[model samples]
Target: MLLSPTFSILLLQAASSLAIPGSVVKRADPVVQLDDTTVTGIANGTVNQFLGIPFAQPPVGSLRFQLPRPLPSYNESFPATAYGPVCPQQAFNLTIPSDLPAETQEVLEVMNSGSTRTISEDCLSLNVIAPANASVGSKHPVIVWIFGGGFEAGDPAATDGSVIVNKSIDLGVPVVYVSINYRTKVLITLAFGFLAGKEVQEAGIGNLGLQDQRLALKWIQRYIGQFGGDPSKVTIWGESAGAISVALQMVTNSGNAEGLFRAAFMQSGSPIPVGDIAHGQVYYDSLVNQTGCSNSSDTLKCLRGVPYDTLMDAVNNTPNIFSYQSLSLAWLPRVDGIFLTDDPQQLVLQGSVADVPFVTGDCNDEGTIFSFANLNVTTDDEFLTYIQMYYTPGASVDEVKQILDLYPQDPADGSPFNTSDQNALTPQSKRLAAFQGDAIFQGPRRSFLQQRAGKQETWSFCNKQSKALPYLGSYHGSDMESIWGDGAMSDYFLRFVTNLDPNGNTSINWPRYTLDSPNMLTLLDGSIPLQITQDDYRVEAMRGVSGLMLKYPL
Candidate 1:
C-alpha cells in the first residue's frame, strides 16, 4: 500500500529540510533540521545520539484517557542532548523469597536501576542513535525498541542502544536505533490509560498505551529518514511487555502492517489468551469507587477531575505484577472493540496477523520470578483453589484436575527443569511457576508459531545462559544482557536487523522454524555456547495448557 499525501508531505519535509552540506558547519556535535526545528545531537565516537524528541502531543488534562495524537509540526529548535522524563510507573510492594541468593537480587536491581528517572504525564518522547557519519539519504536499516515491564513499569532508558549500534558498526552493517516512551499508570485523578469496561469500550479509549505506540510508529515513518534511516526497512523489537506489545502490533489493524514496520523481533512475549475488555469490570469499578466517582452520572468525567494524590493512591492499592495475583495484571491491554477486535490468540487463529518475518523466544525458566508472590500457597488444596480462582475461573473440577495431572506437584518435574527438588521455596512453588510460565509465556509463543510458521518466515530460541542461577534458572529477561552487551545473541540480532535473517558469514546458521521441523537456536551454559535442538520439550503438556487457556481466556 502507498502512503497518503499528508505523510508524503511530512516525509519530504523531514528529508529535504534536514540535508546539511558538509562545508556549512564544522563541529563535534551532529545536527539535523526537520520541518522548522533544528535538532543538535551528541557525538559519542561510534554513534551520534538525538534524545528526547517529542513524537506525540502530551496526554494530560482532558486528554488523560484519550488516544495519543501525533505532533503536527515542530515550531522551535531544541538541543536533543539528554533523555526526557519517563511515564509514571505503577508501584508494587513485592516480597522476594528470603532464601533467594543475593546475586539474584543484585541482578534484578541492576536491571531496574534505569527506571529511577523522573516521571511525568508529559512524556511521549523518543530517542535516536545513528552511526557517527550517517547523513541524510544514507538509508541505514532502522530498529525501533520498546522496553518491557509487564505493562505496568518500564522506561525507554532501561536498555542502552550503544552496544547494538557499536557492534553493527564493527560488523560492517550500520543501522539506526530508536526507543520510545508510552503512558503506563496515571498519577492524576483519571481513569488509567488501560482502563476497561463497558464505558471504556463505548468511549473507544481503552488500551491507550498501545495507541501511544502506534502513533510513535507513524511518527517514525514520517521522520526517520531525516536521521539517515530507511523507514521502509524498519524492524520493531522488544522484550517482555514490550515484546507482548510488538506481538499485539503485528496482530492488530486486521493484520495490516500499514507500511510502518517491515519485521518484528520479540523476547519472552507473544499473543496471549486474553479475552474481552469487559472482563476487567471489577478493577474499573474498584478504581471508580476508590476515586469517589461512583456518585456522579458521568463517572469517567468525574475520574478525570479527581485529585492527583488520591488517584495515585488508588492505583497503587490495585494488584500489580508482583501481587498475589501474579501474572493476572489489573491495568493491562484488553480486547477493546476498536483497537483489538478480538482476543490476541484468537486473532492469530483467524489469520489477523501481519505477514512479516520475525523472531520470538524465551528463557529456560520464565516463571520462577513471578512465582515468588504466591509463596503462601503451600498445600495441595490451597494450590488447587488458587489456580481455580485466578486462572481457571469457569473451568469444571474435572478440567482443572486434568490440568493438574499434566503439571504434577513433584518439584523435580517443575521449573528450573532438570534441577530435581532443590528450589521449591514452598511445596507448590515450582509447580505453580511451571504452569504460570507456560500459560502466560511459553504456550502462547508455541501456539503463535505453530499457526504462522508456513504462512510467514519465523525463528525462535531458548536462552539458558543463566541456568546456573539458584531458584531462578534462566529466568525471564535474563537474555537482556546478551542483546544489550557484546555477546553472541547481540551479533545474531545485529545480523537480523541488517539482513532480515540472523545468518550470514557465520558457521552456525539459524534455520527457519516450521511445524514439521520445529527447530530452536538454544543458548546454553557449557563450553559450547550455542546449539540447534527441537522445540518439543513439553509438547503434550503445552498442548493441554494451551487448550485450557483457549477455553478459559485470562
Candidate 2:
C-alpha cells in the first residue's frame, strides 16, 4: 500500500507520546534534573535555559572514520550551558562591499568576526533551548537545525534561534530549538578512501556526517520528552548543504528515525547526483597520492596517523577543489551502497522518498554568490566564451551559434538574471544565468517537487525581497531572514513550525502544491503580502537537464 500523509502524521504523533513503559512521574523543570549541564538564555523577550549534551562518543584518533559510538551514559548532571566547538574548517574571509550601509556593515562585522571561528576536528555537539515555563506536558514541537557550508564550513552556534524560540513562546505555541554539529570537510568525504578492498563498508565511512545527524535524532527521541518537547513531532530543517542533507535523510532508508521527526524544511539545497563507488575510488586514490600514503600499510590507518593540520594543508594545495563550474571537489556524499543506495534525483523521479510534509524553496539570487568567479565579464563575447567553455562541453561552432541565437545579447540594457542578477547583465548574461541557475538549483528544485508532488504533502516558495541590500537581490540565505527574522518574519516561522501553516486567521489562502497545477508561494517586498503563481519554465528546463543527467550519473 502507498504511504499516506495522514498516516505519517498519525504515526509521528503516536511516536511522540511513547515513553519508558511504566514511568509516570512528571516534573516542571525536567531538563534541570535530566541533563548534567544547564544554563539560562534571554533574547527578544524570551528566556531559554539550554542544556549542552553529548549524543555520541568523540570521533577522534582511531574512531575518526568509523560509525559514531553511542555517547557514554553520564551518571551525574552535566552543564550544557555554552556552545561547543565548531567543526574543523579552512579559515574563510568574506569581503563586505564598500557600498553597504553602516548599520548593515556593523551587522556583517559581528556576524563574521572572531578568532574562535577557527575550525577543529574535535567538534561534535548539540545545543537545546526551551521556554522558561517549559514542562513535561507542554508538548512543544521541536526543530532540529543543521547548518550549511558546502560540506566544508559552518557552525551550529553561529545561528541564533532566540528569535524563533521567542516568537513561538509569545504565540502560546512554545517550541524546543536545537542546533547540532557534525564532522566537516575531509573527515566527511574521505571515508570512501578507507573502504577500498573491504568486504562490508562501515556505517560511518561514506556519509558519516549524515550518520552523526541520525544519532542526534535518536538522542532526541530518547530525551526530548523530558525537556517539554514532543519527541514524535520533531522537525528537521537546514539550508544549503544542510538542505541537501535534509533531502538525503528523506530518501535514504538509514534516515528513517522511526518516530523522531515528522516534517522537514529544505532551503536552497536539493538532491543532485552523488559520486558512485567507482568515482569515489578515484577520489580515494587522489588522497593517497597527495598525502604520501601509497605504502602497502592500511590506508585508513596511515591517514589517521597524519597530523590534522598536515592533512588540511594537503587538501588546500589540491587544484580547483571548490571550483563548482569544473566539479573538482571530492568531499561530497557518495552512493556507497550503504546509507545511500541510489542517486537522490533518481529516487525522487521514482517516487521513492519518505512520504512526509515538506517546505522547500530557493532564494531569488542563489546563483549570484556562485557567479562571483565569473565577474570579469565585460562584454558579450567574453560571456559567450565562458558559456561554451564551462557549460556545454565539446560544443562545435554551430551549437554555440544556436545557443547564442536562443539567448540573444542586448548591449543597451543590463539586468541581473535569476534571483542574483539584480546588477543588470547583458541579455546574454541573463540567459546564461537562467541556464546556469537551472543546471545548479532551479532545475533540481522543480524536478524534486514534480517527483514528490502526487505522493506527499509539499509546499513551495520563492523568497524575493532585497531587504536593504541593493545589488544582492534576495541571494542565497535570504529566507533565513523570515525563519529567524528580527520581528515579523520570525513570528511567521513560529506559527508555521507549531502549526503546519504560517499564515494567521486573517491571512490570504495558502494552498499546498499539486502535480497537475503547481503553485508557488512568493514572499515579495511591499505590503502586498504572499501570493501564488504557476510558471513552469524552471520545471521544463529541469526536464531537459534531467535527460542530460542520465548521460552523466554522478
Candidate 3:
C-alpha cells in the first residue's frame, strides 16, 4: 500500500524529528511532571530544566529580516529538553599553524574549541538553570547572560551554568541563571536600512537582533516566577558584544524599563562608535545589489524573498577586517533614534545613562592577542610610515611625520627582513598596543568611570595574570578563565558572581572607583595582589590621545 503525497510529507517530517536529538533526559522531580516533552536538570542539589522555550516566533519565510514577533503560548506543553537551533553564522574555526607563537596558538586553540565551533542560524533559544530546591516563592536574584562574538557569532548554549549555579547555592543566594541567543551577521546589520522609511520600516524594523534580546527579557519578566526568580531583581551580564548590548539596553528607553533589570555587569565590550544609518545605507545597497533583488516599492518584500543561503553567502564574503588592517568592521549598535538616543560616550559624559551599578575592566594585553593583524614594522622609519598610513590618513605627509615624531619608536628594537618574520620585536608593536588598548578599552573605561563616579557605584580592575601557553602577560579574554574556570582565575569570578564582590574578606582590599581618587585593582602574578595609587603611564598616554580624538566629532 503506497502512501499518498500528503502522507509521504508527514512521514518524512516525523522521521526527521526522530533523527535529530529530540530532548534531554529529565531527573526525577515532584515539582513538574516527567513527560516526554519536559526535561529536568539538577545542579548544586537543585532540580530544574527548561529547553526549547520560544521567546519569539520563528523568523522564517515572510518574516525573514523582519523584527521578531512574540511567540504565542501553546495550549499544550511543548518539548524544551534540547536547545533550539543556533542563529545562522559563518564558521570561525580557522586553523593555526603548528609553528605559530605559543600565545597565539593557545588563544586560537581556545577560541576554536568545540564550544565555539558549533554555531547555526536556527539558534535563537535560551536556557535556564536554577537550584533544584527552589520553591515557587523563592524570589532569588536572577542573572541573565548574553554571549559575545564581536556581534558575529556566539550562543548561550556554549556556556554551562553549573558552576555559577553551584556557587550561588554555596553563597546561600540560590539564584536563577538564564542565557539567550540573538541574530547575527547580515541579519543584524542589513536590518538597519529599514530605519529611514516610516511605513515599510515599521513592518521590517532594523536591529531585529536587539529586538530579539528585548523580547527574551520580556519572557523572563513574564515566566521567571515559575522558575523561582525575582524578575525585579534581574541582573543583565555579558562579555564583548554582549556587554555592549547590555549597556545599550540601560541607555535606551524603548519599553525596556518595565522593571526588567536592576543591575548590569559589562565585561569587555562597551558602547564605542558605531556606523550611522547614513553610512550603513551604503552597505545595505551593496547587499541589495549582490542579491539582485528588485527595487520596487516593497524593497523589504524583495529582500525577504531572496534565498537564505544566497544572502548568507554574501554576508560571509563581505570583508570584516579593514583595508589598512587597522580595525575590525564596526558592525555594532547604532544611534537609531530608538534604542540609542546619542553616542554612549556622549551620554556617559553628560551622565544620561541609567544610574545602575556597573563593574567594568579589561585584560592587560588586549592588542597582543590581535598582533597577527598588525602591519609588520621593522625600523623607526617604517613604524612611522605604518602609523601615518593607518592612523593619520587625512593629515598631510609632513603632518603625519610630525605626529610620528611626537610618539617616536624605541631605539633598540630589531627589524624583520621578511614579512613572515615581522613578528620580531619593534617599537611599532608596543606603541600600537598602547594606542589600541587606550583608544579601544582603557580610555572608554576611564571615561565611563569619570562620568558615573559620583552618581553611581562603579568598580574597575585590570586583569594581568596570563595563562597563555608561553605566558604573554594576560592578553585579551584572560578574564574569561576567571569566570568560566578553565584556569586559576575562576575562584575570584566565583566569589564575585555569588557574593557580588570579588574580594571575600581576603588580604586584598578591592576599593570602589571614584571620580576624585580613581584606584584600579591590579590582578598580578603570584598570590600577591597589587594596587596602583595613580593611573598607569599607558593609561595617561591613551587619555591624551582620547582627548585629542574627542576634539574632532566622530
Candidate 4:
C-alpha cells in the first residue's frame, strides 16, 4: 500500500480516475486465455492488469470456517477490470490519546482509516498486473504480494501493483505482480480466517487466511503462465501482517515450499512467538456467546448459520490492533496441527524452515505507532503489570524483571532511539515503545534471520527514514512508500525477485546477512541515502525478549 507524503492516508487510491480530456483514448483491453476461460483485463499504459479473478470458490455458507477449496474449473468468461469486494473488516473504534502530539494523533487516525470498498464473504480473489506485451511465451519472473492490515482488515484494492510492474519495466527486469484478498476477522466462522479453539483444532481449519493465500499460490502455479509468468520463479512478498504470513508460509508444512514460491521478501513481519490455536479459546468462546452459539453442540456450524451482520457486530466488539490490548490481537494466525504443526518459534528452532533465499527487515521504531493505545500506563508499576498481564503472562517474575532491567525507564534509552530525553509524552510511553518495538518487531526478525542465516541466502535492512517524527519516530509501516512508490527499495525488490539476489544493477552492493557479520542495509533520508551497518543494536535486550517470547508464546 502507498501512504501519502503527509501520512494522512494509509492507502492512496489508484490514479485510474485521472483524465486527459480528448488527448487520451482508452486502449483496447488485453485478453488472456486460462484453460477454457477468456479473461479480460484493463490495459493501463505499458501494463495490463487482470483484477478480481477468483482463485477459490466463494467461501460463504458452509464453507465459512473451512479451508479454502480450489475452483474445480474455469469455464466462463471474466471481465477482470475491477477489484472484488473485500472481506468484512473488524472495525477499530480506538481513541487517540489526548496526550500525544497532534501530528502523532493524526497519523494514528490515518493508519486506522479503513477502506471504503464493498465487503462480502465471497471475497477470495486475486489480481495480476503484467507487461502489456507479455505473451504466453514471455515467461517473466512473478512477484505475489500479500497486503498487511494487522490481520483484521485489508484488501487487494489497498495497493496498486502496477507501480512495481512499471518500475520493473523501467529497470529492464520486467516482471508480473499479483495481489490477493483473503478473509479477515469478520468471516462468519467466528473469526473467519483465523478461528481458533479445540473445535477449529480438531477440525483442522485454523489459519484460513494463510490457507486462502496458499490456494492463490496454487492457482498462480497452475495458471500464471497464461499471463506470461514463470511459475517456477515466483516470489512471495508482504508487509506487516502480510510479512508475518510470508514467514509463517516459509516455516509451515514442515518447511516445505510445495513448489509454490522460490523466494520471499518481507518487511516489518516475521514468524511470531504464538502457540497453538487452543491459545485463542477465550476469544473463540466470547464470539460464540456473543453470536448466540453458546447453546449449540456444534458451535462452528451454529456460527455459520448466524446472520452476517450479527456475526460481524460480535467480531467488531473484540480487541483490534489499535485497542488498549494493541498487538495482542484477538484473532491472528496460530499453530494448527495440520497447517502449522508447532509454535512458529519452535518450528524455527527445530530447523523446520524453508531454504529459500529471502529478505526481511523493519523500520527503526515499529512499536511507537502501537504505543498510543497504552498512554495511560504511566508509572513503572503500571508498566511492569501491563507487560505481565497482557504481553507475557507465562514469564516468571524474575524473567519479567530481567526484561524491565534490559528496557529501562529512562527516556534517553527509549525509542526514537537517538532523540534521547525527547518525545516521551508520558513517563512510560517511550519505555513501552522501546520494549514493544523490540519484543514484537525487532526481536522476532533478528531471531528468525539469526536462526536461518547460513541455511540459505539472506539479506536484511533497517529503514530509519522519518526518524525525526515526534513520538512515533520512523514508525511501523513507514517504509511502505520506499517499496511501493518507485523508491530505491522497489529496485532492490525487483532485483531480488528476478535473480534471487538483490544486488545486480542496484546502485549499492547489498551484502548478504550472515551470523558472524550480520550486515544490514540501512536506509536513511539525508545525503547518504544508504549505508551498511551491523545489525547489533540492543543485542542483549532483543535476545532477552526473544527468550521470553519462546518461554511465553503469545
Candidate 5:
C-alpha cells in the first residue's frame, strides 16, 4: 500500500495520536554511556528519555557571572530522571483575562499551580529524547530547543519533547530532541547576566547566557552521538528572547555556527538593535549599589564572591518584563565587543546572518499581554514620557509623534486584531499595545526576513488564531500549543525537523520567503483554512517604526 505523500503525512499524524507518550512502556531502564561514565534513563514505548544531564559545570561560588564551563566527565552510573532546579528567578504572575472561557481558565489554573517553584544557581543542565530505535545505524537529526522569557526569565524544564519524537517515528523520519537551561536575568541571562560597566567592558565579557547556549551546542556536537544523534546535523530553535538568542547565534562569530548547528528556527524574535554594553550602566550600578560592591576595586570579582541569596535579593529588586517598561525590557542581550562586536541589526544589514535554511514567525498580537502592565497610561503626555523613558528615550518630539500617529489610539486599529471596540482598556492602552507589537516582535522579524531571504532559504508565518482571550489576541507564546500539540503546526515542525523544510510531504506547501513574493503562512485555527497570504499587515506604519528603532534600539 503505497500512500501518496499528503495521505502518508496524514496517516502518520494518526499513528502519533494512538501512541501518545506514557501510553505504553516497552523498555524499563536505558543506559547511555559517555566517556566510560554511564547515565541511566527511562524508556517509554516510542522514545527513550534522558533528563538532567549536565552539559556544563554548575556556575556556583567563584564561577558566578562567568561564562559556562563544559563538564569534564560523567564517569559513574548516574540516574538521569527528574529535572534539575531551574535558574533562580523572581516569581512571575499574570493577571488572568476576565473574559476567558471556564475551560480555558481551568487550564490556566493547572499550568500556574506550579508557578511558585524553587530555583538554584547550580542550574546548567540539558535533557535529550530520541526514538527508541535511534542508534549509530540510524543517526537522527538533532533539534535543540532554547526557551524564552525576554532573556530575563525562563527554564528549560518548561518544554517536553516526547510527542515530537513520536511524531517522527510515525512519519518514518525519526529525530532526536534536546532542551537546554542557561542563566537569565541578573542570575545569569539576558544582558543582565553579562552585565557590563566601564570596568567589566574593559575585561571583555558579556552575553554570558548566549555563551552558555553556545557551549551547550558544542556539548551536543561532542556527546549527542552517544544518544543516537548526529553531530553534524543540528537545528537550534527558540521563541521571544530565546528566538532573539537564536538570531544572535546565527550572527555570532560573523554568522559562523562553528560547525555546531546547521539551521535555525525562531518565534517572535529577531536580531534586535540593542546598543553596546555601556548602555546597561544603570542596571550595573544598581546591582553594585544593592550588593554593597560599589566601592570595591573589582566589582565583577565582588559579585562572584557575594552569597547567592544576597545577589538574588538585589536582582529581584530590579524591573522585569512585568514592570512599567513592559515589552521594552531593560535586561536582554546587547552589543558586547566580545560576543557581539556591533549592533545586531547593523550586522544583519551588512550580511552577517547565517547562510542556513531557517523558519521565523510571530503571533498576530505579540504585545497585548506584554503591554498589560502599562494600561494605566491615559493621556498623550504620559505616552510621550513613556516613549522617551523606555522605548526610544532620545527620540525627538517629532519622531515620537510620528510613532503615535502610525499606531493610532483607536481600539479597532490596535492589536487583539479582529476585536472591534472591546479591548480599549484606556485611552492609550490599545495604542501602546499596537506600537509594542510591531516594534519589539513584528518589525524586527520583518526586516530580518527581507534582509536574509536572498542569502538563505527562509520561511515565515503569522499565528492569527487569537483564542479569544479578551484583549490578548494570539498573544506572545500562543504558537506553543499548536506546535507542541496535535495540530498542523506540530506536523509542520515534525516535517521541518525531518527535512529542514516544513513542506516536505504535507498538502499545505510552505513557500520559501523572498522579497519579491513577500508572503507569510498564516496559522489560523490550526486547520485546513490555515492561509499562505501576503505579508502586508501594516507595511508603511511598520516601516516608520523601524526608522525610529535606529534612534532608540530597545
Candidate 6:
C-alpha cells in the first residue's frame, strides 16, 4: 500500500527534526537484542550503556510485595537511554537541625549524597555498561554493584558505572558493570521490600526487593552475553546495607549460588542477627492502621489501594532508624520463613554460606557517621534505655550494666577508636559509636570471616584513608571514593573482578584471613601505605558484645 502524500511529508519532517545541520552521522542508537526484543540504548564515548532495562515486570497493583515475575518473551522495541526512576525515598536534606556539631553535619552530607531524589514504584530496573569494544565475541568478566542506604533508601542512578568501565579499559582489563534498583523502606517515604505480617507470611511474599535482585541476576545469566559479559564470572559487590545484602544473598539458598554468581565483596556490613518476620508485626500494624487498612480483608492489598502520598505520610511518621534507638531499623529484611529459613546468624552457624572466594572489611570508624543521629542520648539512663530498646530489651539490668562496663565511658576506649577525647560530640557519643559499630558492622563481619576462614579464601581490609570529618574518622563509606575513583582500592577491585584475586599485578602482598593469623590489609593515606596487619584490635570488645547481637539484633 502506498503512503498518502500528507503522511509521507509528515514522516520526512520527523526525520529532519532529528538531524543537526552539518553534523556527521555516527551510528544508529546502540542496538541490543535479548531473545527477540530489541533495545535501543545510548552510546557515549567509549562506554556503551543500556539503562533502565526492566529485568522483571513492574511490582504494582496485584503484584505489590509479591515475588518478582520474569517478563515473558517479547518482540517489541524498548528505549533504554535514560535511567528508570528510583523507588520512593523520604524527602532528604530538608531543614537540618542547627545544634549538630560541624563534623556531624559534614558526615550527614556524604551519607545523604548517595540517595537519588527522583522516585516511583516502577523502579525495578538495571543498567548495563560495557567497553565500546565489547560485543558478542569478547566475553569479559562482570562486576555487579549494589548501593546501600540502611535498607531505608538507595538508588543505582545515584552512582555512575562508566568510571569502572573506563578504568578497566585504561588498565587493559576491560569489564562490564551492572547496577540495579529495588523497592526499599516500603510504605515509608520509600518502600522497603520485606515488610511482613501474618497476612504476608501466609502468602510467602516477603523480601520483595531481594527477589528483584535475584531476578536481575537471572536476567544477566540469560542476556548479559549480548552486551559482552561473562555471566558465569559475575562478582557481586556492595557497601553498608548493600554489603549486608551481599552476605544475605550468600545464605539465602543454604549456600547454593544456583550458578547466579561466583564471588562476593562486602564493605562495612554483614549478615545481621535479625529475627523472624513476626518481630516486625508492630510496624506492619502501624502501617495498616495509618493507611486506613485496619479493617480491610487483605491488609497488603488494602495498602496497595491507599493513596500513595497518604500511605507515605503514615509510614514516615512512624519510628525510623534515626529515632532514639538509632540503627535499630524496623523495616529491614528479616527471616520470613521463605527466602530466609531462619535468622541469618543461625544459617551462618549451620555453614549455609556460599563456599566462594570473598573480601569483607570496614572503615576505621564505621560507627561515627551512624552515631551522629543519637546525639540526644547523653545521660546514663538514656544510654540504658537505648541498650534495652535497640540491643537487648529482654536483658536484666545486670546485662545492661555489663554492657556499660565493657564499652566504658572513656572516649579513647570508644569509637573513632583512638581519637581519645577529640570527637566526643556528647558525653556518650563515642561510647554509643563503639557499641553500635561492633554490634552492627564490625562484630558481624569478624564473625562472618571467622566462620568461613577455613572453608574459603577470604581477604579483609580496613580503610583509614579519606578519613573524612574529624569525628567520623574514615567513617562508613569513607572507602567509596577509592572504590569508585581510579585509585588503589578501585584498581584492586578491577583486578579482583578480572581475575578472582585482587593482587593481580601489584607487588602488595594481601594475605588471606585465617583463624591462625587473622591478617587484614590496612589501607591508609600515605606513601608506602597498605600494610598487612593483624585483626586483633577490639578483640576483647567484640567478644564482650557478640552475645548482645545474638540475643537482641538491630
Residue-level lDDT of model 3, residues 320-421, one tens digit each, is 322233333323455555555566676656556766666777766555444345545656677566655544444456654543544435421111101222
Best by lDDT: 4
Per-residue lDDT value at 20 in model 5: 49
Q: In model 4, which regions exceed 4 Å deviation?
A: 1-25, 98-102, 187-190
lDDT of 5 at 267: 81
Runs off by more than 4 Å, candidate 6 = 1-28, 91-104, 113-117, 187-192
Instruction: Note the residue pairs that clash in candidate 6.
Output: 88-190, 184-191, 184-192, 185-191, 185-192, 186-191, 186-192
Worst 10 residues of 3 by lDDT: 1-10
TM-scores vs. true structure, each candidate: 0.93, 0.80, 0.80, 0.96, 0.92, 0.92
Candidate 5 local lDDT, residue 490: 73
List model 4 lDDT by residue over 1-554, tens digit each: 21112252233433443534456667899999987999999998889999999999998898888889999999999899999898888886667767766777777777867778898999999999999989998999999998888888877776678878988999999999999888776532228888989998988889998899899999999999999999999999988888998998999988999999999999999889898788899988998999999999999999889999998888888888888878877788888888888889899999998889999999998888878788899998888888988889887777788877999999999987889899898898889999988888899999999999999999999999889888889899888878876665878889999999998877799999999999999989888888999999999999998898888888
Give the number of the best model, judged by TM-score: 4
lDDT tens digits by residue: candidate 6, 1-554: 00001122223345645655455455556888887888988886677889999888888776777788998865788889999987865433322357766756645654544343567777788999998778986889998888777666777765678878988998899999999887777621134476766776887877776777888889989999999999899999988878888888899998999998899999887888888778778888988988889999888888877777887787676555555555777677888887888888889999999888999998887777667668888988888888887777767787777778888888888778877688788899999998888888888889999999989989899888755456777777777766665555777888888888888676487888999999898888778667888999878778778776787654
Model 1 residue 368 CA deviation (Å) reads 0.3
lDDT of 2 by residue, 77-171 (tens): 55566677766653333455576556545433433333265455666778878776777787899999987765655667665665467667777
**lDDT of candidate 2 vs native?**
0.61
> How far does residue 173 in candidate 1 sit from its true spot (Å)?
0.6
User: What is the Cα-based TM-score of model 3?
Assistant: 0.80
